[model samples]
Target: MKLLLVEDDSDYAATLSRALEAMGHDVVVARDGVAAIEFNDRDQFDAIILDRMLPQMDGTTLVERLRERGQTLPVLMLSALGQSIDKVDGLKAGADDYVVKPTSVGEIDARLHALVRARGWKGEGATTLRAGAILVNPGKHRAWYGDDALDLSNLEFKLLAELTRHAGSFVTRTMLLERVWGYDFEPATNIIEVQIRALRRKLTASGSPDPIVTKRGVGYMLEA
Candidate 1:
């Protein structure tokens, strides 16, 4: 997932950034609330990690401003103030979740997953995805084509889920690298082509017309 991390503490921010990258998340660091707002305005992010105390603007006020602007991105507020009242105040300001400072990256990752699950890709309570004859259930880690269940590996399932989510829209190779392989830096191996080849082979095993469309130099798309 792509994330925007708002932190004034450079050292702590660097450490946390490294940890999140190691967990396969791409992070953009913002040193202050103003920088955070700028980053949020410029790009897309799966979530935002905010610090309570910030230069230029406070975290609560920043969240409130984002809400006022009609941005619904999930926010996880971090603060040294671990009191129950502090948490309540953060939530009231439009933060999706609040975590105390010095929290582990594992805890943060879990919380982010929970937030994504709550704000499902399809809808508020959507659990399944469909593109043409293909059907995918990410929560169950299962997929099917017509009446036949697709036997996909872990990575293949994730790759297919992303494709099905977009359905008719083309998905770029870069997007697949970040979303499926979770790599901020590209590897030397042609992993995307290899995985797509394998997935394609399986998908067409039932003598069905290939649903994945390759645009040669552009990207891949699942036919809707």
Candidate 2:
């Protein structure tokens, strides 16, 4: 997945970028809100990670601007202020998810993954899905491949549910970010790829064929 990370802290950005790359994701970094907004206007990204306090324009204002332009990209906001009031303010300003600063990259990745999956549920009302040998129970939040139960994390379960719900349909990276991760702003991060890899590992471990079909330059689809 291609992600945009908007952060003014060079050291933190560098460290996070390296971690995401190590997990097989493509990351684009923007130093401040101005560059972040410019990047959003010019290029498409799967997801975005934004810092609450930024130069040029604050994260809240940037999100408001994007909303006005009718852009529905997923955004995860980061801040040092972890107060509930602050989180509410961010959400009211159009953020999908909010996290305090000094958060682990792993947790950020998980939250982003969840946001994407949430965005992918399109109310198809499909209760069950079969891909290869894998069986998904949407209502029960469980999956199995043959006799082996597939152990999934909360984020992983949501991811599978989304893919299965939209089985055979191409799910855009942006869509995944919006619904699954609940992000209303775009960030520069490679969270989608990271989560997919983890999900794949779990699926494959259950003796199932890879059910996820990747469309280069587009997004992902679950094989019908």
Candidate 3:
């Protein structure tokens, strides 16, 4: 996997970069947030490690900018402050995970693996998943119907992958929220319904049959 390390501490960055490299990961180091953004715009990375304090641009600003540009790459924010509020602020700024400084290289590597796994959780181990004519490739993060590729958002891909994995089996909305969205508590908002509706529309846009079967008040299923 490729990683972008945006940190100002030269020694820490060098040590961490070496560790990741030894683990067979391609690591790109940026000394500051401005350089980080420039590198990010020019290169594609599997994950990003960011420091909260940076020269020219802060990590929060960088994260917000990346999100605004629709870049959904997994970001793990690193900070010296381990307070819950600090963590919350980082997440709210668009980081996928947060870790305090003085962390072990092993722990950082483990967290990186977890964040990347979670991002591609739906397609991690599976090669091909079929639900009627729809086919999904979890490894490649791609999906298709017959010969046509389906353009789906990150969330849509995860939702489709989950349903297709359990084809012919009922999957409740709560399960989707918990598994796909990583939500522990149910939100009052109908996010599942909204996303499903969007997915259905995209599926049928090419005149394909809707493989997703709504189970009314119970949940959803993909017919075999």
Tens digits of per-residue lDDT for model 1, 57-107: 999999997665545668999999999999999999999999998899999
- Write model 3 residue lDDT over 1-224, tens digit each, in one string: 78999999999999999999999989999998888876764555788999999999999999987665445678999999899999999999999999998898888889989987887833212346666556677777887764467899999999999998898899998899988999988899989999999999988898888878887888999775
In terms of lDDT, model 2 sits at 0.78
Task: For each candidate in the order shown, give its overall lDDT on alpha carbons.
Answer: 0.85, 0.78, 0.84
Question: Which of candidates 1 and 2 is the stronger one according to TM-score?
Answer: 1
Error of 3 at 183 (Å): 45
Model 2 RMSD in angstroms = 18.4
Ten-residue stretch with the least lDDT total in model 2 = 121-130
Judge candidate 2 at residue 47 and give its lDDT. Answer: 74
Where does the lowest 10-residue lDDT sum fall in candidate 1?
A: 120-129
Which runs in model 1 stand beyond 4 Å of their true positions? Answer: 121-224
Give the alpha carbon lDDT tens digit for every residue of 18-125 in model 2: 998887778899998888866764455667898999999898988886554444567899999899999998899888999998989899898878876877622212
Candidate 2's displacement at residue 37, Å, is 1.3
- lDDT, candidate 2, at 3: 80
Question: Model 2, stretches more than 4 Å misplaced?
Answer: 121-224
